[model samples]
Target: MHKRGQSFLGEVRDQIRSKEAKDFVSAELNHHLKAAKNKWIEKGMDETEAEEKAVVQMGSPITLGQKLNKLHRPKVDWLTVMLLVTTLGLGFLPILFMDADYYLQYNMDASSFSVQKVVFSLLGAVLAFCVMLVNYRRLESFGWLFYSIGVLILVLLQNSFDMINGVSILVIGPFTINSLSVMPFFLLAWASFFNHKKLKLWHLSLLFVCSFWLFVNTVNLPAIYIYTFMVFGLFLCSRFSRKIKWMITGGIMGSLLLLGFIVWPSLEMYQLVRLLAFVNPEQYAEGEGYMMLLLQDHISKAGWFGNALNSGTIPNVHTDFVFVGFTYYFGWLAACALFIVLALFIVRIIMIARNIHEPFGKLLLNGAVALYTVQLVSNVGMTFGLVPITTISLPFISYGLIPIVLNAFIVGVVLSVYRRKDLTSMRTFQPQQ
Candidate 1:
């Protein structure tokens, strides 16, 4: 309560450049002053004298603030940055050398596609950088807003969206937005919701049920899978009681089972055929399994150092099957190397998430990791015929403007969390009585 303590804290705050770090620094400094003052008071010193001595014991405010400033300064994970850049470069190779004949069949220009990819990549990089500079903590309070926006986007896509290759897309002028694009909004929203200290079990259940219904209505299987996995990941990292956590886990499992039993019969002929093909690709080779068989054949022919094979016949070679095409041209060794880089990129982010002390930041990173991991595993698994084929794109490597940009935004968020990991205190600073 002394003027001396207040003046010292003000001086300390002046040295801290980051506005986000200022509150934490001030709180911690005040806590220390209060504790020291209480100690002097216990020793029978006068109140004013104790406060003055406590302030003096903290040493020069300018020096202490400068030290704290250095510790709390924004950091960049250059190693992760390098790994991401390496993966992006490797991903561009297949697109750069895509077969022109394949584009002709779809009435598209190969040259323009490559050029567009280049533009998108640049835009994605810029977006990542821009997002990295933002304070992620500011998003914690906007959970409901983000959730509403995400649900609205999904509803629009579900009701009146243009159909492209059986996938719903909203075409706005020159840009086409897919259902998957709503993921980041939902991811951040769920992260905020899970980290909420006062969120009730009933309210959480309602939110999950509503989101699940919207996702199901969209019929984007990849988005559904990613969303489900993300929610589970967030729940596991949430600060809920063990009983509540288990209840939620059981509820999700039961819902999925019930949906499977009810939705299976209602699935369209093509959807049923796709599922059947996944179970027995050889039996449905002439229909939905044709692509699966072709992928296997190409992968088998792709040697450690390439097989000199033309990958023109592969469908969506530049997008979904880009990995197979890359393997055919650059060899399995190169593909594995690329995979290692991707894995390292993911691991680096996980490591950063582990070090973060802030609940919301950690949740955000975990949610992103969950979504990316599922997309990576599912996409690669399908390419290897280990999982059912879906429209999931390889993160960062997929040839789409929206996917790349959205992925970059997620990466930027991870960077933002890493930037301030040191600045966050483990517990809230409180002044000693």
Candidate 2:
């Protein structure tokens, strides 16, 4: 009966709630039923009998629909959710105690900055979730737009803005946005789409030139290094040839060395002193190396449990040197726990990146993971005098608005990739008969 064919598809549609699942099942069933009907027709059956036979041979529509529904369901990554909760719990705990009136001994002023920090943190969290809901493929269309905006910001900051203590901050009315923190996100997004059939020299040159100008203008060495590493990771993960990979690697290395050469001479005496202090902190303990010396002193005093937040008089202890202050306050065991959680998060991201189905998504995630890894190492290393203090914020634990929001957005994009790891896409469509 012709009605049998209609009944079969309708039964499948009734079993599956999502249109995507229903369409997919209907297409597969139609394809199979057409073949079965042809087989029956060639075997001497009439069209109506053939249609009825095809419906029977295609198996139970309810069972097939149930299986397809299970396959197409959106999967939530519970592990990532739990890890993020642990990270946020540990990260916000310090600010809670530091800013609370009951804990302040010297009548600390309760400024609006603290309230804004919490507000931005919540906003960042919401932004990340919103980004996850968006289709990542759609973001590819805006790659150049994002890149141009970043480059434009750097250009404006270099030429039009007045310098604040020798560093440029883009001031828009009431808010001063840090160009260093924002530029890398755009650059990394640009890098994600660089994979091509043939690796063009001009494309590579464009990337180098933009990165070079950003580095020259901002003079934020740590951010530049992270951005550079991200570019490297992006290229390495791309589908380029081995020769091209080597060439890109060499070009990046050469460019970094040349940039350092050009930027080094322009550095102030104190900046040069800070670079030297990384080699030997004690030799310059009273001068530019004082931060490193003080950081070491604070870390040394913090036993396994910490000095209960009695971090010595290190300037900007709550910002640049917060990790040391944290270890000194919470103890080394808590620091180790923090380290374990961070390590697991990075590892989880890497695992997800590797498993991602799309090349662009994979490359994008590689850049993000590389940026986070570099920032983590740089910040933690600075806390113990292992690396030069470059004023880089610790990824999730830092006390800053831009870093928190940007990091949340990055994590959200990664989660978007993870959530849709199985299906390359889902599109609304009508089922064909």
Candidate 3:
């Protein structure tokens, strides 16, 4: 080739070598060649001659060495997965082996109390695992739609009058759906996840008002409070400390004002009893304080080793006061171990949230952590008389199917965050494992 032709080949080769050169080559190459080729054609070179001219004009293919570089992929944290699965197994197996009859005397044969509850709990985990395999970012666009559907289902369930043995499956089914409770969690989290929660005051105001509306309509303070804490946590994660302070002040004042004016319950009845019982156990002792008395007395009998499963005189040891079972049958060390696992669960969620660079994935993980922490603190606190009982459970430790299933699904969302890649930002990453 001529010296100029050699220079042309070198330029083409160098452009192909550097991947970054792709944009420059893509934009300019065809135009540069077509013009050069037309000139050759107009001068009476044939089509094949013009094509040769165009190829030579762009430079030679031999110099394209950059194509040898391979694209990089993100690293997976398999250790995290292994540790999580092991913990879940430990947490779940106790409930499976303990036997349902050990839980409640009255409803021992009921479907809610039957062995099938375990299936629902595991199913929730299964569903969550499948969902985690989906890329999480893709949900932002459809968040509102998913949220609305969750709300609509509760609304429809509320209108039912049918009952099994006087217990309505609609309002408090084998599950519970206080429109006021679950919907706020679904919607507020969705709203907060998008846009780094760049919500205007009106947007926040709207969520509160909608929550209050649903609360009054349904009368579910425990669920509403759970929802409130979750939303507030999401907002805190999204905003600055100063804004959080202002929001909290406004929220407290607004909550008290609403409590005063509305006929709605502020301290949900069960929680109110736990509060009053803790304060004046004598005045409320016979009627409302009975369970607390039983729980405290049973825990007193528990020593270093603790009595065996059926040895304790505790009633309802498997359900509401299960932590007492941990303390009583398994001893204080087991109770301490319960908290340790709970701590591990929350810390794992925080680590996942911190590692994620994207806003939505972080919010998803934050929501899961906040939700679990709220329930964990209240349930165990009430058991020990530190906080009022609000009918909350110990997350995965509690065997309630409906709520546990929902929590399991949330875990799947956390798994989605870990599966994402660095070079390719997929919307949701669903992992098979």
CA lDDT of every candidate? 0.82, 0.70, 0.60
Clashing pairs in 2: 304-332, 305-331, 306-331, 309-329
TM-score for each predicted model, relative to the true structure = 0.91, 0.81, 0.70
TM accuracy, model 3: 0.70
- Model 1, span 1-433: residue lDDT tens: 7898899899999999988789878877787888889999999999999999888888888988898899888898788677667766765787554666777876788678778888888888888888888888898999999999998888888875445666667778988877788888998899999888788867887998888888787767787888888888888888888998898789878987999999998999998888899888899989988989999988888889985555446788778887887777778998898777777767887898878878999999988888778878888899898988888888788788877887788788888888878886624433323
Please give the range of 10 consecutive residues that has the lowest summed lDDT in model 3. Answer: 65-74
- State residue 122's C-alpha deviation in candidate 3, in Å: 2.9
Instruction: Estimate the lDDT of model 2.
Output: 0.70
Best by TM-score: 1
Off by over 4 Å in 2: 1-61, 96-108, 111-113, 160-162, 181-188, 196-201, 254-271, 309-311, 424-433
Give candidate 1's error at residue 263 in angstroms. 4.8
Q: Write the per-residue lDDT of candidate 3 for residues 302-417, one digit (tens) a residue.
A: 77666665555555555566777777777788778768876777887887777776777777778778777887788788777777655566666666565566566666666766
Pick the winner on TM-score between candidates 2 and 3. Answer: 2
Point out the worst 10-residue segment of candidate 2 by lDDT: 424-433
Which residue pairs show backbone clashes in model 1? none
